[model samples]
Target: MSILPQLAFVLILGAAGLILRKRILFLKRNILLGKDETRNDQPNERWKTMFLVAFGQQKMFKRIIPAFLHFLIYVGFLVINLEVLEFVLDGILGTHRLFAPLLGGAYTVAINIFEFLAVAVLVSCVAFLIRRNVMQVERFTKPEMKGWPAMDANLILVIEIILMFAILTMNATDQILASRGDEHYLALGPLFFSRILQPIFMGLSDGALVFIERFAWWFHIIGILAFAVYVTYSKHLHIFLAFPNTWYSNLKAKGEIQNMPEVTQEVNMMLGIPVENPSAPPAEIGRFGAKDVNDLSWINILNAYSCTECGRCTSECPANLTGKKLSPRKIMMDVRDRAEEVGKSIDAGGPGLEDGKSLLGDYISKEEINACTTCNACVEACPVNIDPLSIILQLRRYVAMEESGTPAQWNAMFQNMETSFSPWKFSPSDRFNWSEKVKEEEMK
Candidate 1:
């Protein structure tokens, strides 16, 4: 009969595991729907990038207040999860304070630290809630963040705050029960932060205190499990994806645009540039660039799914600053939305990418892509190292290569660059005249 609670716990955990596995598969399948591209060149560099950017929260320091607050929550939440480990073991073994007797003094110290961190996490979350909602931060209030995105951000914060409260509540009630000489509740020294709440619960009966403690324990664990599953669908999916996203981030110089191998090879053949390997296979070329989620690389789609939709990229974009339609943030969101739409359709026996809808025109507009200055501001601004410009370039490639011709001004620049080796109308011979004219003006 005592094992019944343990059995129920096992069942609940197993269900959560199954649901989490389903979400993982759904995310993976949608991401893999994209074309393959090589992003696995440097293991050491990738690890460093992940460590510095994701684990270390290095880039987030650009805005110190939010970064510090976020770091407190990030670090505190992680540290406090150690206590959660004890909670899980207690649940499974059907024991109260399972680690307390084993670790003794160390367990008390550990939980005290966890309690302190829990308080820190609680405070940090409240600060973030105010910054995001009450303060109405500009980056957070963008058009893409209007509905679900905004609510998801707030909801995650609220969940964390509530979970922190559950921890404090459990500890306070456990302390009270311990004082009352409850056999099951071992007195784990003073959890200083939670002790402040002792007076409030002191008036409660021992039975009531035990019930509250048990309820809070269950609540904390259940909330964590549910939060894990909810994150896959939330912008907080970055919680899992940031590591991989930063690792696979573009390693080359930011402004150095990637050229099509097919186009490069063709140009090389025309220039009589010797082929490095004569026996090598010819470059593969099909649809010029991304028309839909199907047209982008797996990493690109991964980038879409990994997107936090924080609007940092859009907020930093020069075009967006100039009141252009281009929100680099929106481009990523559109790709993710299109991928989900297509993935669901294919799963439902619908037309998939061929359903007369595409990522190019139907989801992301031509004006949005065209408005990009390609200044790489969005790329630089992304905290998790998400490359929105890479996605933008691919969409632009479809317009130029497949759909034929970019904006008229871009066409003129392309023509000039090909003929005169410049983006101006001047002939190659007269290109030096500008330098001479500069010299003449200096003399005058």
Candidate 2:
């Protein structure tokens, strides 16, 4: 209950706020570096998507066991963080249990519920760690998950375990001190999990008990604050980004490819479709498609940040399943990596960075792009509604239109589509020849 502690609390909060603000701004800037596209329409549908996909975890439920475990952690983390509001108030005012008097009996209930959730979170985190490390789940140990991705997954699980332990420790010591009738300790009957731990702290001196309680309390709050900041730099950013990403998710039919407006206009003109403003000056032609992150739509870039790297998309991808170089998860990671590189370069100098590298060659490869069948499996598999296929299509477009780099067989197919109106070497009039042959065979 000192001014010094209150001041220190304010300083810590301010520092965390400042760093978090900078990180958020950096992410926003990087995401917006991509070309702008409208995804703001259909507000109702967007909200429904956010609710079902992000909040309800609709896609996650496809796998029941993992889904149930994830639900516990998700709910526990969000619910437990509600206590942070009281922690903040107490820290700023140098008051202990600031909400205890206001809530009266309900305070005990809330604390007990929080302790239950804390224990659940600890157990769930441990289970996830075992699944990732001990069980070595195939989806988790894919080549893309080798270094930082693997370590990051384990680190977050460990951090959650430690934070949950801190919570229990704080509550247990506080309960012990309250039983001893220590000043400033609230007599909140007993938190279930903490009550179980109370025996460990028995017989400790009043001052020692107080010190342990204070240490746990400070550690829990500070750990939460640090986790908040760390998530922005980690794949766990999906925890926050999933909401908006799902809200702005593509609502168009999965098989329907989005046509380029410039190309559409040119085609309309070529077909003599009674174009309006025929005398208008021609629009400047930019790159045909996304050669770099900047050429992609902002939503596409946002998808990269929103990716959980769970490899569900890769697991479902036909390309990856059949010994192809393309991994949908890797595509997302590469886009994020490239975006961060470009964002940092621009932050350091100015606009363009002549890094002599691009998302296409340096980060992602043409082979990977061509490997995609565009079956929409990856998009469908994404729990947060990320459209890695959209990025893939854009990159493929760049390869086809800008570089004319399609393989010989693909180029032949393209020529057939243009001249024969089908991906076959035959005249348009002969398109039904196979059908006639099939009918004759059936008759025989």
Candidate 3:
């Protein structure tokens, strides 16, 4: 323990903190770029949702095998990180096993528990890698996952394995050093998993063993800090965003679609209902629906950011099963990519970048939007409660209302709805005629 290591630790920790802060601020700004809507109702329900979905991971259990494996990694991540508090204090205060003397026997138990979790995490990561690469799970190899998405997934799994190994290695070497009465080495009973590694290092000289132990110690802590910052830039961001995203999730009935106030007012006027008269000049007209990220509600953007890209949504989507261009998972990924692009553009220039492209044409396409049956399957399948349907509806609204780009069949259906109050060509007065004909045929 020296001032130099403490100072280096402080600087590394500070740099990671600063980078993470900047990324978080950028993400906040990007998410806030969307239109504002109030979702602050039912604080009690919101908290319950966050606890059940994010913390409890209730939705993940739909598929028992994968769910159990995922739970191992999730629990491992949380439990193993408990040791990080000790790591921080040790690094800053130049102490070793700072909590060992205080906790007494409890320290050994905690270390053993951490070691067990570390092994579980390592095994889980390897299993995940095999699933993604060797087994080539269909959902994981979708077109959207061809490049960086695929790499990002593998990179995270590998990083977790490495970090876990670092922890076990550090513990094993520390145990060996303690046997030799090395300074600052606590003689806690050997951690089960780490104890197995001790035989491999027994032949090394005292100085080499010390170097290996210190290197592993520094690598584990530094790797964890680096990972904290890397998560903001990776799909792994859901690790943190899932909590708030679930907390602010849409709590309305699944089948309910929020109405456009302006459209509702116009419909009211057409139906001869009394409407409020404007007392002053009207506000400037806005686009009918979302042509870009800015026209979508903030929650929709947040959904994009919080997406895990697990493909459950896409796997469940009927349109995708039928070989349509649409994949709800891809839609969310596109939205996130477009939002990131816009955020970077604004960072480089100013608001002037708004004119160049949009989420509609640049990232998502009309065919994909049209393919949606609005079955809500994607919404139902999302473990994180993301509503890909909401984004689809907004983009569809922009196409139909602003661009008037619906196909001829859809246009005919729209015309029928406007005049006949149904999606058929017949008048509303004759809407029941088909039922009457069916009754007559049955009677005959």
Candidate 4:
């Protein structure tokens, strides 16, 4: 068989994968509605976040075992390409170790290291499955206990298992081939599988060994391609999206919201509010933040594309876990559904209008935004580094600043911020009260 067939196959598959990845990323890039200036506005902070979050995977490691396991998975998946390079050549060109001792033996060492991590990845994946299915970890369940689409959860599990099995199968096949005494053999005894497979392969005929090797090579190659295509359609899409998403994650403080574009006084502000008989329109107003699906910031749409739906954000969210009616997964999913709907309108050249018939009318209720604690746990737990809290803050800014419809409890707080330069509703005159009391009491 010509090596060209397999080479062409891999090249074709790789190009298809790259093209799909680019198209989706481009679609996401153009659909974002909100402020993206924060991502590049501060180069130093963006660099720091990139290094700390993307390179270090800092937040992921908060739960030590899982973090460590993911590290192995991430590093192993990256370097496992060396083995793929070998497999493609051996399978196609009929020569093993085509790049013998390539990268100054770095490739060889990577093979062993990745194999070790492969074992760890399998074990961790199994543990996670059991934790989610059997133990019913709170972090894995839906907020209302209504249960998620089991298909989505199970799809992720199956992908990880297939990935691990493919690694093990490839390593086992390589070891078996090595034991047959082929001159092309590189040392394999050091591999954990070699010791176990040595006695068995030693007894097999050359013809039998060759057939098994061919089968293994085919299985490994086909399995990996299937896995790649499957990932694009699954929640595991974040396996690729998360790193770049986190690198571009919003870094502003919770309350420091983005400003809407300004308008001239003659423009008739006409701030939107569904509430009946609300106050008069302002002197000028831009579109209220997220009044409708179309009004959402472009970054909000990006949040949808980037969402892993791992339920990590929902799990860590105090509001959702406590049953106060908030789920980050649902929020992202809603935004996604709406973005797709609005995107169709935008594509059709229709004006993206927001009246009372808007996304904000019911699903994303007024109560829901105010319910958020702004605790930042959801932001912290998000593997992709999505900041739903930022969206909520921006929504609040619109409600408070434009509509002047601040929630009652927050009304006093906003007033304090304006009058006293703080959210705490206390007189500035009383600021020295604590100092005076402390000094006098201590002296006495």
Candidate 5:
């Protein structure tokens, strides 16, 4: 047995692993660039959230048709990977069907199931392509989704379709070679889906069938390795991040805005509520909210990285629905983009975040952030529990508090809240004066 294939496989796997390690490290550094905040308070609840939302895909079911199609691809991608494990083992060990003899008849049953899933994934991918291109799914055709975003979505689907085809073709060619008494190939009986494909290769000679089978096998494994590295760069990073993102998701009720800790600390001191940490250094003031990625919390950056660019958030946003410029999906994408830009600059030894440009104004416009109604519709609409509303709120807070760039009307309301403890100009005692008039009118 020549060691060449095993040696080549190890080299390819190693190179892919090294590249992935670097990419993952860069992503982690980018996430850490944000200020730290704790999301570890409710461990048990977090586990449940990850299970139901990420693993079970609970939120996806809200849209039935696309949900079912997505479920097909998701399930198939997972189950079919069992066969991929065999491929990896075989590639490294210089052997084929390592599990076949151990499991006997059950091996064939497993392959049949994998084949079925491969077909399902293939069909589902085609449907996704149609939805993105032919149907031009409204949420998919948004302005932010044009150019590379559109191509990226379609490209991933096409890759899945091709990978599924490779699996089926490899199985079909292998069965034919085994029938021709090829020594290396196994006769795993006809897999349900691949069985129908046998007639196409029946006319091919044993050598040709063997070559096709080997080519397909190599292509499939290499493709899988490539996909692993590619996903880190794609919006499909959500495939892995969706788990942790959902796990650490903001558990507060929709529209239940959490107080910024730094600002809260200052307020508590002002109200004479007593400090929790008297000896500790004073909490920094003035730099209130996020003007760049660094001002946001780590989980906020995680939410950015976990975005699927599905545009459901933007679609459901009341502001966007009413033809406003606020696109929640765009907000998340901008965060991720800005982080990536900063991270790459640091890597290149540039001035990094000090380069003058910021997430505000450069990537995301003040008008877009201001247009949001803080309705939380975007947060509720995310299938993976991403909180674009949180990012939007932070941007708005930065404009209002840090730069004092809010509109005059908003400033007036701010003054009212500070003075009367309400959002109106009326004094507290006269707040219900209309009720007094109503009573007088009724009496008359």
Candidate 6:
């Protein structure tokens, strides 16, 4: 019935709950306004998705060592919450531990077990930090590599190290309290560092040691709460977003583009992309494709927010490396910016908007769409499995279906699609054209 530990538990739980609540509410509001339904209608697929993305970490494996470290950290961090629960109960309830009974005589054995896991978690995080700092993987690159805030990449490593040390400090304090003596032998994991400082505890009288134990106990709780709040605001927002994005990723079909309405042949439409907007749309077709953020489906917007901005897409983008006017990172940023503009305009009855025209003209340009090779590199590179190809394809549909406009190469390919069932432009009747040479060789 100690009040200090109870207070610490309440503070940690309350702060974590508040941060989680706010994040969930924001995500829900966006989903309701977005196009696709966030709910999973397919039960079988949902289970498959949960296993593959959550348990498997399939996408992360594309880059071996870092992915392996990330997987270990993620799994260990989640499961180690069991150890945290034991601390809270033992610290407050004066109980030996909650898990020991469930785990049998192996209660201390389990503690000894997680002590090793704690060390593994610590080592993995250190490896991750080294990878980000020294190797400078493409995914970790920031605007400034070695300056103030030391880049977000470095900050992430620092946060992880702090959390681990905080946990170790708390464990060391607990050992000192239980043993009522120097923690010389029980030192394990990072607690070994605290063990080396056992001389300080030996120097202090019992009254001073009691105060240190209580303060360290509360400090650990406060640290957990602060980490929760940090997670909500940081680039590590991916910790929250990655799960949902993977659950909802397009698993059923990879190549199919969503259908846009037929604007090209609409009888009443005289001035759309192909006709009225000449230079912007096309002389013959008027207007087509995304003019602004609203023209995009809800899925496109989800892709924007869901991007970890890990730079995986940028690293693999053909247009980005080739010096073309496209970068998937920029595309995601444009979608976010355009969506915010349209939202403000709508809120202000269009007064906040400078132009009366659609968002495509002001936000995403036709040239940006054309820059994409539709190579699926971005699709393959994304750790959370985002499909930039689908977004580009949707824009392609906007152009081909509405404007009746395309590059000469695309036009020829489409013509072949209509006449030959293939993109090679050969007649269907000439299907066996290559067979004649093979037949002559066989006769010889």
* Better-scoring candidate (lDDT), 1 or 5: 5
lDDT top scorer: 2
Give the runs in model 6 whose Cα sits over 4 Å from its true position: 1-12, 37-42, 87-105, 142-150, 181-212, 261-294, 333-368, 395-444
Estimated TM-score for each candidate:
0.94, 0.96, 0.96, 0.73, 0.96, 0.71
- Residue-wise lDDT of candidate 4 within 14-72, one digit each (tens)? 77578678656545644564433445677777778767776777877777876787787
* Backbone clashes, candidate 1: 0
Q: Name the lDDT value of residue 343 in candidate 6.
A: 56
Q: List the residue pairs that clash in candidate 2.
A: none
- Tens digits of per-residue lDDT for model 5, 1-444: 889989999999999999999999999999999988888878999999999999999999999998999999999977988888999899999999899989999999999999999999999999989988999889998889989888889889999998998899999999888877888887886598998888999998887888888898899999999999999899999989999999998887876887877777778889999878967898666477889999998899999999989888988999899888889999899999999999999999999899999999999998898888887888888999999888888888899887999989999999999999899988898878889888999999
lDDT of each: 0.88, 0.90, 0.90, 0.65, 0.90, 0.63
- Candidates 4 and 5 compared by TM-score, better number: 5
- TM-score of predicted model 5? 0.96
- Tell me the alpha-carbon RMSD of every candidate: 2.3, 1.9, 1.9, 6.9, 1.8, 7.4
lDDT (Cα, tens digit) per residue for candidate 3, span 35-108: 88899999999999999999999998987777888899999989888899999999999899899999999999
Evaluate candidate 6 by giving its C-alpha RMSD to the native, one decimal: 7.4
Clashing pairs in 5: none
Error of 3 at 29 (Å): 0.5
Query: Candidate 2, residues 1-444: lDDT per residue as tens digits?
Result: 359989999999999999999999999999998997988889999999999999999999988888989999999978987999999999999999999999999999999889999888889999999999889988898888999999988889999999999989999999888888887898886577888887888979989989999999899889989999999999999999999999999998999989887887788899989666779877787799899999999999899999988899999998899889899999999999999999999888955546878999999988898899999999998999999989999998899989999899999999989988889887889767779888999999
By the lDDT metric, which is better: model 1 or model 2? 2
The model with the greater lDDT, 3 or 6, is: 3
Candidate 6 lDDT over residue span 1-444, tens digit each: 457756656666776788878765554444334444444678678777757875678878888877888877777677767777776676556454456557665665655555556666778878877777787775456442335324554666676666666555555555665566443223222334455446656666656765766566556556665666665444465666667677677766555555444444453256443444334542344235554444555766666666656677877888877767666765675665555555556555784335575444465566777899878788878887776776666667667777766688889998889788999978899988999999999999
- The per-residue C-alpha lDDT of model 4 at residue 351 equals 53
Cand. 4 Cα-lDDT: 0.65
- Candidate 4 has its poorest 10 consecutive residues by lDDT at 260-269
Q: Candidate 1: where is the Cα deviation over 4 Å?
A: 270-284, 418-421, 434-444
